[model samples]
Target: MTLFDSERPYKYIMDTSSILSQKPGETHTRLVYKSQWERIEEYMRSHSIVTCSEIFEEIKDKEIKEWIFSQQCTVLEIDDDIQNNVRKIVTENPKMIEFTGKSGTSSGDAFLIATAMKYGLIIITEENKDKQMKIPQISKKYGITSVNITSLCEMEQWKF
Candidate 1:
């Protein structure tokens, strides 16, 4: 049996952190039998995972990019609404300077969250939920639902 049903009701907007965290595949680092890999691949195809153009640019790993392409992850086009939301978040909360090039941290975080807000998609990231000025903290402040990869698997009852 495979997992790509295409009728699933949720869309996940992945962050670069989650992309880096997932690597080539969840079980690829381990010994994934061919069938298992196929099943996992099907699961990945079952849902729509999207990210903004900025988040796409943040990823430098070629293999990860290939995998993202294979998974059919949607790279959404950024427009005025998304960009303005990010600017508003940064302007209203200077403490989120870390997301605004503070210490050279890419403003990709703001862009990712802003994309989620504009599209009403759930945020998927591996960032520490307790850290200040990070995705989770800022997401909470804005009432956006943020989750980790593990939580996503759990939500789908995916043992993988």
Candidate 2:
């Protein structure tokens, strides 16, 4: 079953995995290599797509980072409400947060989910739903809809 409703003008909160995914065949990476960035740019400009600020820290590609910044998408700040929601998620599922081999744990996944919870938006993530301790699974557990990049293209009927 599809994660999203058959509604017009869908809005989404993107996870870092979705943004940086490089799935083989008809994926964003291939699209970008084919000089189809304009299509994606147009789509992003037209859609109500946003992401958490932590995506910046999670994304390792400098070019993609610059591209995202240039797209002018709404970068949701981790305010008190989002922080509280993240805490709740972490408390309930301690395994959701991963250690980044740094001083603190990686909060991108939690923050992305929390942002979606706060805004009541669907989550766009490349994480497999079958995998444990992943965004899709955790999102499903929390009653949130999560779809992959390919699903997003299909749902939106992007003719590319």
Candidate 3:
């Protein structure tokens, strides 16, 4: 069975950055405002889409991790297929050169995008750069739609 077979076909994919925003932390403060948290909860509960464990590690907030587990969010498993796809993206995407610079995009981000593409999922991220420097750009290149937390809330009609 597909992940969203019972519900609407899963259209939304969340990056660690987007999911991690709901958790309290220094970066979390800047990631998303307090008003968005409620909507995030509502959306997750209603939609059944969520970030993977790699995303959890990037979050760096214990409370958020606990909350994620408590919510029973589906944890994506990284297998050979996902790893191969990530490698393919890294090798093929020229923009990745400029985007990551010396450090390069993390394996987690690549895996997230690859998994989304493989499953035909829409990515949700906060990075606003127009180019393919972030997941949004990569998603765009792969023809996967992407949006921010606030936009998602609006789409879902999630009210505080």
Candidate 4:
């Protein structure tokens, strides 16, 4: 089954980095910050936005982690196809994921890309385009579209 509505103009899958971009500050968290977070949360709740379930492991901030869980967004599970694609991506580009000094768990970069490939979804990420290992670059190699949150908003003509 498709994760997106066939009638919708655009369908997007978010990477952990892009999701965390809306996170509030540690000190002096203002109302506007909370409002922005809530707005994104509301959008996710109503939209066909999806994200890899593995992102839960990558999230370290308690508030951001909680926000992710609280949202009603669809969390894509890792299937054999996604796993195999992830293997191919990781084997070909080791720098795409940083596993050094960490446990068995790694970043959700590969999973995000694989999911986007599997479902024909455009990736929403915060990684810069200048970086070779970033999602935008790696996704391009696989013929997948990747855009930042700001671009997504502009494309959708969202005011907030």
Candidate 5:
């Protein structure tokens, strides 16, 4: 089912890097950083969410994985449909696809983009890189919106 099929319709796709940045008890400023996963948990309860297996692997910390599992987030698998779609994206965007060779196409970033495109969902990331190698570029190319974690928190009025 598509993301929009849900009653609330999940508006963001969580990436592994974003998840990592949200670890509880992690220090940022003088205070311990609050878990963004908590925000995600609430979102999932009201809307549809999607993530990749690669993201799960990236969160190797047992604590984080267990938290993710407890949240019951949907784990997207690499099936023929996603594979074919990735192939098409690579073929269509040759310049961007080249970066996949060095950094690898099986990256969680690539999977996030492909899944967002397939399910028509927006991407939420913490990266500020403006280069074409970034997921924001791919999201722009596919007409999908992406925002940083801070912006997302602001949008939801979630204060840390």
Candidate 6:
């Protein structure tokens, strides 16, 4: 119930890859994403794992979807500020064009980066930093910190 506490140090926002990769029945030692279902929920709630509606819709796992919806994780809407940031990021990175949908519509990278930048959230995306116009690379230009799922676990100190 305390997903957006101003008292928290930072908000951890996750992308679709984080959901698709880290699901139940996975295994890991240092990272917690591949841990038990209950532990993952506990970790998300305690750490304030926030995400956007676009990213949430990308998740296909029933259990994960249900858990996220019912948990304290904050799912933010795409507001004006986020949309404006997305335009800036997308305009600067033309390479992201190829990553867009078939109709060359909205891209998750833009949304994720914008959300993180506008709200000062720590983005969690599996996209590689070196990839052309990826979240990690674009985040650098916007001065926003973006990390992969494993890196997120390290930052949160989630160990078995």
TM-score of 4: 0.80
Write candidate 2's Cα lDDT for 26-144 as tens digits.
Answer: 34675454434455566566657878888767887787788788887667789898899899999998977767576334578888888788777789887778987888888887888
Q: Which window of 10 residues has the lowest lDDT sum in candidate 5?
A: 25-34
Clashing pairs in 4: none
Q: What is the per-residue lDDT of model 3 for residues 1-160, given as tens digits with 9 covering 90 to 100? A: 3656445545666887677555456344634566666555555666557665566666666786787777666667777777887888888875554544454355567778877766677778877748556878777877878888777777777676
Native-referenced Cα lDDT, model 2: 0.74
Clash pairs, model 5 backbone:
none
lDDT by residue for model 5 (64-138), tens? 788777877777777777777677677776655454456334356666778787777778776554867677777
Q: What is the overall TM-score of model 5 with all chains considered together?
A: 0.74
**Candidate 6 TM-score versus the reference:** 0.76
Q: Write the per-residue lDDT of candidate 4 for residues 68-134, one digit (tens) a residue.
A: 6788777778999999999999999987777687543356888888888887889988778777888
Clashes of 6: 0
Candidate 1 residue-wise lDDT, 88-137, digit = tens:
88997766655444443767888888888877778988888998878988
Off by over 4 Å in 3: 1-9, 23-36, 94-105
Clashes (candidate 4): 0
RMSD of 5: 3.9
Q: Please list the C-alpha lDDT of all candidates, in the order they appear.
A: 0.73, 0.74, 0.68, 0.75, 0.67, 0.71
Clashing pairs in 2: none
Return whichever of 4 and 5 wins on TM-score.
4
For candidate 6, write residues 1-160 as lDDT tens digits.
1466457644778877666565444433224533543555665777567788877876667877987878677778898988998888878887775744564223776888888887788887777779756777878887889887667767877674
